[model samples]
Target: MQFTAKFNALAVAVVAAMVSQVAASPAPVASVVSTDEFLKWLDTTDADITYIGKPINGSVPRAAQDVMVTYCNKRTQNVCGGTCTVYNGPAACLAAGGTACLSATANVGFCDRGGCGGSCNQLSTCGTHLDNGFCFTPGTASIIVPPS
Candidate 1:
């Protein structure tokens, strides 16, 4: 019947629209940075680093390092200091330790010593922080990969 034919045509049009919408949507992306790149940035900025959402430079090396250690739960503590290395996320870096590590792809909180925490990711919040006491802030200067 004509009614059946028209219904089928409407269904086809709906499917096509759905397909177009999916294609038009932006692809999911994560920003990843190498340890070497982060270290270079740290050197240039002297631990005065900040990101897109965070107001002021987030150069708290101790906080970042502690979180990485807890997430990775590594027996050794060599990854935090000396030489630049790549890190995927806090958990991956903590467990692997200086071996081109990767982190949780999504849905994670970055916790500080006093329990101050924030969300983290590859592109927006991906990177390490350092505090070497050279910047003259308080403790050590923190370094992090600047958000893109």
Candidate 2:
């Protein structure tokens, strides 16, 4: 009987210790930003991508751009005479419709053909480049809401 009583007391103590330890543990912190907030900040839906080429200011969201250039190490290559800001990582990349460490981004430029004046293009491709005497200009970044 004494042994049973001690065993029961020991069991209770163990349970109590576990409960106390759990209670003392820190609350779980959010490791990643919320999806809704991320989308909002990204200013685009999963369907479409924001192409922020360089004008030193362009289509990418201010916050997302900051994160990309700062946290994601986006760089300029003059991929189109206009600077193409490429970033890979985190929610921003996914939000930008890019995958595998790259966001969906394209180059920015205009057709420099004597007859194609003002014929603009904003993709990774252009028949004209800086060497072709065509200048680059980034397009506006737009915000989008996903369909229900």
Candidate 3:
């Protein structure tokens, strides 16, 4: 019957429209939490935390170009644990001592020397990704923070 044929055509058109919409949607991007939230998280962690740059306070708004990096002294299984240093500030070479692993809100570079003047690797190209966005970066003695 013509009614059945028309109904089938309508269904096909609806499905086509849905498919197009889905295909046009943009891919999801990684999200970074606010400074306040990050501070709250830092408080909850058991690892010893040290700050290297700008002071962190609830009333102070984090710089837009700053990146939060947390480097740990140990990695067990796929976790970055032990004494950790939390760096929250602008782009600069960070002296990270005994850092075996690290995590960051944005991509950064890790180096083997104290001044970031040796072999370097980007976090985006991490070979050993640990739990919760942490990467295994053994022998890292410094970090290069790129401007955001």
User: Judged by lDDT relative to the true structure, which candidate is superior, 2 or 3?
Assistant: 3
> Mind giving the per-residue lDDT tens digits that candidate 2 earns over 1-148?
9999999999999999999998896742222223233334344322233344232234344543232311111213522212233332233221221111122221222232222233433323422232112222232222111111
Evaluated at residue 21, the lDDT of candidate 1 is 95
Q: How many residue pairs clash in each candidate?
A: 16, 2, 0
- lDDT tens digits, residues 1-148, model 1? 9999999999999999999998896754333233334445445532222222222233543223222111222112223222332233323212122222222223232332122223223323434422321111111112232212
lDDT of 3 by residue, 1-148 (tens): 9999999999999999999998896742233334554566677778887787777776776778988888999998977789899887888889997999887766789999999988998887888887666789999999998887
Q: TM-score for model 3?
A: 0.72
User: Which clashing pairs does model 2 show?
Assistant: 59-141, 107-123
Give the residue spans of candidate 1 off by over 4 A: 27-109, 114-148
* CA-lDDT, candidates in order: 0.31, 0.31, 0.81
Alpha-carbon RMSD of each model: 14.9, 16.8, 4.3
